[model samples]
Target: MKPKQTLSWKPFVLSAAVLLILFPFVYLVLLSLASEWRFPDLLPSYFGLRNWATILGSEAGLLESFVSSLLISLSVAMVSTTSGFLISRAVFYHPKKNTLTLLAYFPYILAPVVFAACLSFFFLKMGLFGNITGVIVAQFIIAFPYALLFFSSFWNKKVKSYEDLVATLGGNRWQTYIKVLFPLAKGLLLICFFQTFLISWFEYGLTSIIGIGKVQTLTIKVFLFIKEANYYYGALSCCLLIFPPIVLLYFNKRYVFKKLV
Candidate 1:
């Protein structure tokens, strides 16, 4: 008889790693479905769709908050990615490119809470305080510079050479971008959109300070539940919060990273 083969540790290690990564998400889902789960109970007294169903009723404004977060994130990502890509091009050609790039890092120097507070006065003066638009603008100020910096690498001597070649071939700036640059930068654009969307999506500090408890995005709702020690509802809110990022990650892996690979 052949000697029994020793099993590889790699598979077990991999499985453990996978479990570690998935445990939080799985526990969150379980918690969301649990009711009256408390100490020494081994498991919840009840588990089902009861907690999730609360979103449909007015017991929780979860659905509304979810919609609000989705809209705000989408808006911030679109505007930031587009403007960043365009402005990065101008920065690449500017004599003060270094200075401009440095300035892009300004918003990041201060803590997000302090940054929001600094902007609060302007927001109040502009009649933007405690509203959705104010939160968007505030988040934009942070997200846009990030986008500008992110796309900086997309423009360089090679890209400039391509632009010149297009110009020589009778392609105008619009045509050059439409036909050459956008195609070249499509991957980066999608990635930046995803990044900026996440920035706005999970943003708590700025949204809280700027909105002043009015524009309650999903993140805020999660905090509110947790603050009240409503763990069951908080878990439910957490599940809702994690849903979009999970969807976005799936698509990013399937469509974006797959193509890049």
Candidate 2:
């Protein structure tokens, strides 16, 4: 018998893909750490943590922006996940499941900017515009569709069967949720949390429109830095922006591999 040949293309393709994704970020980190990276320079003239220091110190409101971003993102994650989980459950069992499912995709499909535009008038009317709480509400509204779709996918035949088994075992709704559903869907819930948090974190269009520029999250800060020709600060903010998601992705990947093992 002839020995089997290995696929030589796979590794090359995968490595290229990884580089494509990571190279920009590597450059961003380099730029962020650089004090001066002028034209024609392959590397920075001065390397220091000045940008980081400036952002972290009271010199800029970045620390305050970071806190605000954290509060908003965390709150959006909690609200979107919890509310979406509950809403998905109802929609899954609803008599008008088809209509509701179709409706659930609307917000997600709409261009976030256009959606924000259409809602801006209503936000004004409801006194949500320019308020941090209002921006949170807008993010939740925008993120709900994604959460709904995600959790809706969780309630498949197998999940339903397990749920029925719990019911047959005399587990009440709360008991079933706490014991069965919670453990079963824990990873998915975490994914949803991260996704929704990320959605809220990187949101510029919706926050800008809804907050009326009053609430400046990290995304806003990055844009502000760029608009003001502060490229070093912009790069620093970019690094900060990508840091959490990358960390979460790494941990999630590790957890998945551990589970598989």
Maximum-lDDT candidate: 1
Per-prediction backbone clash count: 0, 0
Output the number of the TM-score-best candidate: 1
Tens-place lDDT per residue, model 1, 56-122, is: 9877888899999999999999999999999889996799999998988888566778899878999
Taking every candidate in turn, the Cα RMSD to the unseen true structure, in Å, is: 2.6, 3.9
Q: lDDT per residue, candidate 2, 1-261, as tens digits? A: 999998799899999999999999999998899977888998889898888888757776888888899999999999999889878988987788889999888889988878988999999999989989989999999898988888876777898898899899988999888998889889888888888888999899989889887998989988898898888888888888889888888877644333222
Pairs clashing in candidate 1?
Answer: none
lDDT of 2: 0.86
Range of the 10 consecutive residues with the lowest summed lDDT in candidate 2: 252-261
The global C-alpha lDDT for each of the candidates, from Candidate 1 onward, is 0.90, 0.86
Model 1 earns a TM-score of 0.92
